[model samples]
Target: MRYSVSEWTKSGSPWVWLNAGAVAICVIMVVGLLGLIAMRGLAHFWPADVMQATYTQGDQSRRIMGELVQQEMVPAEQLRGAGIQVPDGVEEMRRDLLKVGNRDFSSADFVWAMDQGISDKTLPEMIMVAERLEWGNFYGYLREVRESGETVARHDGHAKSPEYLAVWDEFQRRIDRVLEIRDQILTIEKHEIGSINYELERLRLEERSLELEQSTDAEAYAEIEARRAELNADYEVLQQDLIDLYTKINRDSFTAEIADGREVEIDIAKVVRAFLPNKMGTGEKMAHYGVKLWEFLSDEPREANTEGGIFPAIFGTVMMVILMSVLVTPFGVIAAVYLREYATQGFITRLIRIAVNNLAGVPSIVYGVFGLGFFVYFLGGSIDDLFFPEAKPAPTFGTGGLMWASITLALLTVPVVIVATEEGLARIPRSVREGSLALGATKFETLMKVVLPMASPAMMTGVILAIARAAGEVAPLMLVGVVKLAPSLPLDGNYPFLHLDQKFMHLGFHIYDVGFQSPNVEAARPLVYATAFLLVVVIALLNFSAIAIRNHLREKYKALEM
Candidate 1:
């Protein structure tokens, strides 16, 4: 009988072939998508060069080259004097900047340094001559990467050339030495100023005391006047030293000159590490782990002289996530228990079911708006009027911040927990309950000891799902706790142990920042991808853990499946 249907279907249409084709196409699309992303995002870690027409206006194309660019004008000037023909026009017209694209040397037209020199244009000439001409990216750089130190793309064989690395080391060393020397000089100048001020103060006090004394002795007055004169002279010298120090510190600004269309302009900084090879992008190493997290946080304080630290954001996010979890778990578990165990499938139960299901579909932004109006304005405003009359906006618990974010997320996820727990309870056979009842156990006892335990695994799944949704979600939190930058983390040793009303930072928001709002989009690109991947991983880890727990519970109860 089954053979009849199977045979008919087999002859009617090639189902297997259709299915195979569908699967093949699906696989192809998936692979294509993954490959595309990989090519763009993971291909920036290696070295490549740029080749272009000698004219910038000719073609906006890139060519990969295998040379590094360092600005050492000394040798270039020397070579020019030797009648090296100075290769002026070629170096000047940087049509084809060098770069490594897709992480590796994607194409190979690069042999030696371009013969920009009229003659004797060897690699050494490029390195040593330090061309008076501009240093520009052919593709952009001769390093193994497109980024300074961070690895941009993977599988592209971009890395720092040994020569470039040496140059970087020397350059950095020189800068550090110069900075140290300058700092030492500044410190000495400051000490001199302090000493002078102190002496001046002493001399002024002596003069004041001398004037107050009705001393007929001319010697005492003469001594006081002489000391005052000496102090004045010292103050003049110190003031001059101070001005010089200020000028020196402020004047000698460092700049990295790169090639412009016609001439060279100072680029502010030369990233030799940009010439180094990296398979991943994480900013400069010293910047990352060099105890410079504060520097990174405060680097872009919104304005040029602005100051900010992501510590507050980091703290706020952690607090919001943890608080949201804590607030939602108990309420969700209780609701699920009542629905799964005590409630019957009557009109009331159905209504509750409908309501919970509807709640899950509600727009999170609506919740944020509601929270701001009702919780912040109505409730919190009332509280402020009552107790914190002096501090009108203080005690902002119900306001649009971490507290509201946690609450909104918790509300949004309650339905998920309810559904999961209900399913889990239903999976337990009625026989188990009947047996418990027959043994004289009450409904409450049966639910507590039997149904609830069995349903916990399902509840965990719901919790995990809720956590994933909450953690990665930027929309609701954006209206609630998300902020551009916070000076400190929410979990600081501030007065309040848990500042629910404080603005916080989340990883999702960070993705938005790097990808869209960051000043240097190309520079921050790898960070954005890495942050996104990390968030995905976090969600996956939570869900996988829940699944594992569910599996364990299933195994534990397998023998008792009535």
Candidate 2:
């Protein structure tokens, strides 16, 4: 009554194993793809350091300015002491008294000191800039320079003030600082180096002329030598002062310069003034200059591709889909033609049917490899020789671009069209074909005038399916046309504008580059998700267009009955 081990195994059968294998594969593929896409496309928005930086530039006062915290808040008593009349507003006038306790009065530069991107969450701080380093906002700069006990003018932010000429007078002070003119003529001894070379040269020439005139007296010669020695000693000491001046050149001496047709300078003090969020103009630069904390969630592409009109990737994908559709349609319809019209149901026809169906069941990626090897290298190379001899060695039709990408995708999706067209051809009633032949129509005419017209809708359905598959395919195009960046589009303003030979950008490739291939992974995530969504929408649009065209073709043949 017991069964043998061999008999038990045979009773279980192979179909069970096949079905289980198919389900397992489907689950693994779907789960793996979704996981990979989400992990790369939704994690982080911005880099870390930008979120934490306070002062992006330096703080210097001599040539630069800090925030004007307390410029001109002279009291009425002080004005009266200086014999100046106070304005009518008196104490009611706005004061530059930026105090520490009150949170309402704010300067423009405090929010900039935070250096973070837009946040609706917390209230920002107000910081006052001090005229000297010690008085400036504590965290506004990386470091500060303490001022010397020298006279300095401050702006009152008002139109009528004696210190209004301070900015212009700064250059004058710099000129005087350079010479220290008073230091040279100590008791007409002139032993300091204060632009005294001119006086020394004049005296030297005078002594030489005196020597040439008459028998130069010993007393006169001694007097001339003594005066020349004093000037020489003065020039020598001035040379030492010039050496000291070089050591003091920090941000204090930075001067505005003009160069060949460009303004190539940056004022650090101006940047600090512009840093406060309240002062910025409403533009993109204001959104993220240094860094934004939300970059971790931002979906921006790497480099942002500011050049206004280069959408090469989108163009390439569309071009490839069109080319693939054109190539696959004819081959699929013709093969269906041979099978239905001419190929008799012999052993060879059955074997061909079996082979065609088997090809449809084969994995699409395998077709991609076959296309790369056969169409790109063998058939493509052959055509390049016979028709495109000028582009030798390079193999014009065989390299990566719109042409090869299209051809490769066509080969990959051809089986789908073939199967679909065969179904359409099979759906035709035998009576219709017989009647066409009875009416003295040729078999080819019956196909051209009747059979194909009747089957156009079904034929279109296959095209729609092929396009949908090709539009979202990133792997096959990776081998054929997808590149990280293309300087120019495949189509542009030139002779025969559609340049199929150029490498193309693709949304799929963009997703890969932004999510996986980028230098800053966290900063590109949101952009990657948005891009992925765009790719999905694009594929749907293509399918919808194909469906519309198919419906039109179907309507054109509605009266032709099978």
Identify the candidate with maximal lDDT. Answer: 2
Best by TM-score: 1
RMSD of each: 15.8, 26.4
**CA shift of 237, model 1, Å:** 26
lDDT (C-alpha) at residue 167 in model 2:
35
- Model 1, span 1-562: residue lDDT tens: 3467678686856787789999999999977865655554333332322222222112342232233322223345555565444455433321222222222212321222223421222222111111111232222322222233333222211234556555445544534544564556645544555455656655565555555555577887788778878877877876776676555434322223222222121211221123232322355433433333343333323321111223344445556666777888789888877876777869999999999999888887777777667767777678756654443334545456677778877877778887877788778888999999999999989888777777777777788878877777787777766777654445543345555666777767877876788654444564555445545655676678768977887778666664
Model 2, 231-348: lDDT tens digits are 7776677566654544332223212211111112222221111122222344633454333323322222224421111245566677788888999999988988888778898999
Residue 40 local lDDT, model 2: 47
